[model samples]
Target chain A: EAEVAQSPRYKITEKSQAVAFWCDPISGHATLYWYRQILGQGPELLVQFQDESVVDDSQLPKDRFSAERLKGVDSTLKIQPAELGDSAMYLCATTQGSNNEQFFGPGTRLTVL
Target chain B: AQRVTQPEKLLSVFKGAPVELKCNYSYSGSPELFWYVQYSRQRLQLLLRHISRESIKGFTADLNKGETSFHLKKPFAQEEDSAMYYCALMPGSGGSNYKLTFGKGTLLTVNP
Candidate 1:
């Protein structure tokens, strides 16, 4: 079975440093999502993308965080000047554009020291 | 606005026991509900969706429109059933821009 792929399974960075995570959604999926899950909490939507175009980024912290899908296939999420509170699990999910359900990838665990 | 609620933070049960994970939602429009589970050392995956109305791994959830709830229930729990369960809500009917709002998850621990 094909599954979503994520890079840098675990990352530890000093406060105010830079960190990046990557995700490749299932083929043929047009809608991709980025979410953050702090310890003891459920995942929260950070951004949503539809074929390289951002659909929703209302919850993404623009000043320090950025994401892009250059070819509308794989995506990258970056956090510059990471803060201590930025420690969390970054999850990437995707849907078939016309479907309500989604498939999730193994998350990248970030630890901002 | 759409919201999902999983009231129980943790539920402990023994093997071969009945298990029920509570989930409720608040949405003005027609909503699509789903249950996602994350087992230890595993990625989060969809356990079931309301639209499918199919029982999976001895688990079932019924969408109650009047009550605004879609709770997951299993008649006989197994040791592997221990995992973190999340209830999600998507209120929009339009396929485009479908965003999922997830609830605080419930951790079910099935003891041996």
Candidate 2:
């Protein structure tokens, strides 16, 4: 089975520094999602992409966070000037259709000092 | 706004015991419900969805429209069943714009 791939499984950075996470969705899956999961809480959607176009990003903090799927196959999420509260698990998921199962990646754990 | 609530943060049961994880949701329109599980060092994976009504790994969940609940249940829990479970809800037909609203999650520990 093809799984979503994420890099830098763990990251540590200080506040005010920049951090980035990468994700590659399953082949042919057009819809991709980025989520943040704080400790003791469930995942929260940060952004969604349909191909290379952003379908939704209302929850994303535009001032400090940005995500892009330039090639429509993989994506990159960046947070400039990371905050302490940004310490969380960043997850990437993908689905081929609206009703299909969303496959999740192992996630990138970010710890800001 | 749609929201999912899993009241119990932690649940423990002995092997072979019946286990139930409560999940409630608040959505005005018709919603699709799902249960996702993450075992130790494993990525989150779909355990089951209400639309399919299928039992997976001896676990089953029923959608109660009247009560706005979709609780996961299993008659005989095994030690390997210990994992963090999340209940999620997707509004409408789950089109491209729709997103999943997840509950805080429940940590199930099936002990020997």
Candidate 3:
């Protein structure tokens, strides 16, 4: 089975630094999602993408965070001036359609000092 | 806005014992319910969805529209069943804009 691929399984950075996470969805998957999972809490949706277009980003902190999937096959999420609270697991998921089940990646664990 | 709530943060049960994880939701419109499980050192995966109504790994969940609950249940639990489980909900009507809203997961420990 083809799974979502994420780079830099673990990252350590200091506050006020910039960080980026990359994700490649399963081939042909049209919808991609980025989520943040804090310790002791479930994953929360940060952004959703339909093909190369953003469908929802209400929860994303636009001032500090930005995500793009230019080709609609891969995506990058960047956080400028990372904060202490940003230390969490960044997860990428993809689905073939709007109502299909999502497949999640191994996730990138971010640690900000 | 839709919200999912899993009341118990932790649940423990001996092997072969019955197990149930409570999940409740507050949504004005119809919604789709799902249960996702994450094993130790594993990525989060879908265990079951209410729309499918299928039992997976001896676990089943029923959507109670009247009570607004979608609780996961299993008659007997095994040690390998220990994992973190999350209940999620998505808007039922929205075409492609629907996003999953998850609850604070329940950590289940099935002891021997």
Candidate 4:
């Protein structure tokens, strides 16, 4: 079965450092999303991409967070000058269409201290 | 703005017993409802969608437009059913947004 693939299942970084997480969506999926899940809270959308265009990034902390899907396929999420509050599980999900079901990756857990 | 609410933080029940997970949503437009599950150390996956009107793993959920609710139900729970459940909603449109709003999630534990 095809699945969303994520790299670096876990990462620990110091404050003020930079960290990056990679994700590859299921083949043929047109919509991709990145979410941050804080402990004991629901996952919050950070960025969303349709093909190669960004549809939304309102909730993303622009000062420190950046995400891109260069070819509209594989994507990367990066955090610069990471803070303690930046520690959380980053989830990547994709859907064939806007109204279809979404498939999620295993997620990359980041710890910043 | 659209949002989802899962009241219970945790729910515990014995195997063979019935189970229910409450989910409520606040969305003015016609919303698409879904239930997703995350098993221990596993990736989150789709459990059921309101439109499908089908049960999965002995679980079912009915969308109540009047009440703005879609509560998940299982006649008899199994040990394998223990997992975190999240309710999500998608706005109705070209749906090109493809953004989903998820609830905090309910941790269900079924003891054998």
Off by over 4 Å in 4: none
Docking class of 2: high
Model 4 misses residue A67 by how many Å?
0.8
Q: Over the stretch B37-103, how does candidate 4's per-residue lDDT look in tens digits? A: 9999999999999989998999999999999999999999999999999999988664688778999
Per-model CA lDDT versus the true structure: 0.94, 0.95, 0.95, 0.94
Clash pairs (backbone) in predicted model 2 = none
> Which regions of candidate 1 deviate over 4 angstroms?
none
- The TM-score, computed over Cα atoms with residue i paired to residue i, of candidate 4 is 0.98
Error in Å for residue A81 of model 2: 1.0
Using lDDT as the yardstick, the better of models 1 and 2 is: 2
| List of clashing residue pairs for candidate 4 | none
- iRMS per model in Å: 0.8, 1.1, 1.0, 0.8
lDDT of 2 by residue, A36-90 (tens): 9999999999999999999999999999999999999999999998999999999
Question: Alpha-carbon interface RMSD of model 4?
Answer: 0.8
Can you tell me the DockQ of model 1? 0.82
* DockQ by candidate, in order: 0.82, 0.81, 0.82, 0.85
